[model samples]
Target: MKASEIRELKDEEIVHEVRRLRRELYTLRSQAVTEKLENPRQFGVIRKDIARLLTEQTARRNQAKTAGAAE
Candidate 1:
């Protein structure tokens, strides 16, 4: 998923997407270990997507914290 698309998602939606991606990643890893994956590059793509979602979430959390602290 594109970072721009992810960033446009609501916070709750982003959390749900992260959970879904992690589950998919686990399934992909198991498939890779037991058999040949159709697309091994998917692993890297999922990982980066997860990272981007997490990064955006963290940034939002930190921004909230800083805003609260400033109040």
Candidate 2:
């Protein structure tokens, strides 16, 4: 998913996406170990996506903290 698309999601939705991605990553890794994975690059892609989601979540939290402090 694009960053813009991720940014449009609510915090709860973003968390859900994170969980879903983690599960997918686990499955992909298992497939790779079993020699059933056709494309190893999928693991890298999923890892990056998870990182992006995490970064966005952290940014949101920091923004909220700053906003609260300002208030």
lDDT, each prediction: 0.96, 0.91
Candidate 2 structure quality by residue, lDDT tens digits, 1-71 = 88998899999998999999999999988887887778888888888888989999999999999999999
- TM-score, cand. 2 vs. native: 0.93
What is the clash count for each candidate, in the order shown? Answer: 0, 0
Q: In terms of TM-score, how similar is model 1 to the real structure?
A: 0.94
Minimum summed lDDT over a 10-residue window in model 1 is located at 1-10
C-alpha TM-scores of all predictions: 0.94, 0.93
